[model samples]
Each structure stands twice: as structure tokens, then as C-alpha cells.
Target: MSILREARLSDLPAIETLVKAAYGHYVDRIGTIPGPMRDIDDHRYARHIEAGHVSLLFDNADGEESVDAGNGDKPVGLLVLIPQTDTLLLDNVAVAPSAQGRGFGKALMQAAEARARQLEFDSITLYTQELMHENLAIYRRYGYVETHRAEEFGLKRVYLRKSLA
Candidate 1:
């Protein structure tokens, strides 16, 4: 099983490492550093943690003891959830490359849905680069529908939304 909890300041380093490992490969495919790669900085994480917008998903399958036990339960995935008036924006979801095929990404999406419900959101929204076919497929498989397409910051972005109610 995996545990999801708010990220603490101490987890910043590990979170940064995970984000880099997860998004570094996309730099070549997209011809530029992905948004997540450019945005995953310690200051940004600190701000998000302070605002209660970041969550770390820990994999316990390895029988890890605790997050505070000196890297025992290192995070396998991270999420940046921003709650809006009627929706939760899934700004970022990154699963460490080493942990990729273990269902962590799907687990994190499920967690994000739960979070949206808990926060009383009626829907959730996210956007991905138009070139990221795999991501688009995964979001679609999770029931997200494309709402529109636009060029943002010079990247063609496909916005998607899933209604919860």
C-alpha cells in the first residue's frame, strides 16, 4: 500500500530528486524542459508546503518503517493540488522513474480525486503538453475529458477536466 500525506519542509530534497528523475527524460522529447522540471524548485515546494498544496505519496511495499526513520519510507510519488472555488487543479503529478510501473501514478490520481472530494470540489482540472501522448491517454483512462486546446508559454497545451458530481 501507499500512504498520502501533506509534504513537510524536510521532504523538499527528496521531492526535488523525484521530480527531476521523473521529468528529466521528457526534456529531449519536448524540445524543452517540461513545465514541471522548470518549476520544481525548493522555494516553490516550500511555498506549496506552507500553503498545504503539496502531498507526498509513500510506498510501503518495501516494508518501510516510517518517513521520519532516515529515508525508510522515501516518497515514490508527489502531487501538487491547488483547490479552487469549485475545482481542484492537479498542477503536477510525478512518480519517480524507479517507481514508475508499480501503479504509483494511478494511485496518486485516485488520491487526487479523494482529495478533491474531501475539499468539497465538484470537479478537477489539469493540463498536459499536447505532445505528451502517454499522459493524455492516462488522463483519459481516468475519465478526464479534453476541454480545450491552447498555446501557453509557447507550448501547445491540452486542458482536461473530470466532473465529480
Candidate 2:
């Protein structure tokens, strides 16, 4: 089974590590550091965790788990949520490279949706780099519709939204 929980202070380092490993591959593909890669760090994660904005995904399936046991439930995936007036912004969803293709990503996305509902949000919003076609497709498969496109921080982004109600 897999578990999703809000991050604690001790999980910041692992979160940062997982995020870097998850997003590092896109650096060369995008020809520049992805905004998430450049923006995420231990301090920021610490703040987010403290503010109740970060959640982590842990895979606990015996014999199928990939995380190290010594780390004490080290997270394989992460979700960063920012609550807005009427929506929950999924700022980031990342799965460690080693944990990709194991349904962890999809589970994390589902957890995000459940969280939005729990928080009384009517919708969820997110944006991905325009160059990351795979991510855009995955979000669409999750029922997120393209809301618009814009350039920010020198990168083209495709914004998407999904309604829960």
C-alpha cells in the first residue's frame, strides 16, 4: 500500500532531494533549468511544510518498494499545494526517477484531488512547462483542461485546471 501525508520538518531534505532527482532530467530537454528545479530548496520546502502546503507520497508495498528502509518512510513522491480563494493550486507534483512508472505519480495526483475536496475547493489548477509534453498529457488524462498559456521566468508554461464539483 502507499500512503500520503503532510510533510514534517524532518522530511524537507528528502523532499528537496526527491524533487531534484525527479526534475533533473528535464534540464537538458528544456535547454534551461526548469522553474521548479531553480525554485525549490530546503528552506522553501521547510516554510511550505510549516505552512501546511506540502504533502508526501510513500510506497509501502513489500518487495515492490524502492525507497531505502533506513530513511524511515522516505517519500517517493511529493505534492505542493497552494490554497487560493476558490482553488487549490497544485504547484508541484514530482516522483523520484526510480519510482516512476509504478503508479506513484497517478496516486499522488489522486491524492491531490482528494485533498482539494477535503479543503472545500471547487477546483484545482496547475501549470507545466510547454516543452514538457508528457506532463501536459498526464494532467489532461487526469481531467485537467488547458486554461491558457503564458511565458514566465523565461519559460513558456501551459496552465490547466480541473473542477471537482
All candidates' lDDT scores? 0.86, 0.87
Q: What is the C-alpha RMSD of each candidate to the true structure, in Å?
A: 1.8, 2.8
For model 2, residues 1-165, the per-residue Cα lDDT tens digits are: 887777888887788788789889899898888877776643677778899999888887774544442467678899999999989999999999999999999998988999999999999999999989999999999999999999988899999999999
Over all chains combined, what TM-score does candidate 1 have? 0.92
Error of 1 at 137 (Å): 0.4
36: Cα error in model 2, Å: 1.7
**lDDT, candidate 1, 22-140, per-residue tens:** 88888888888778776764368778888999999887775655554145567889999998776899999999888889999999999999999999898999999988999999999
Clashing pairs in 1: none
Model 2, runs deviating above 4 Å: 62-72
Q: What are the clashing pairs of model 2? A: none
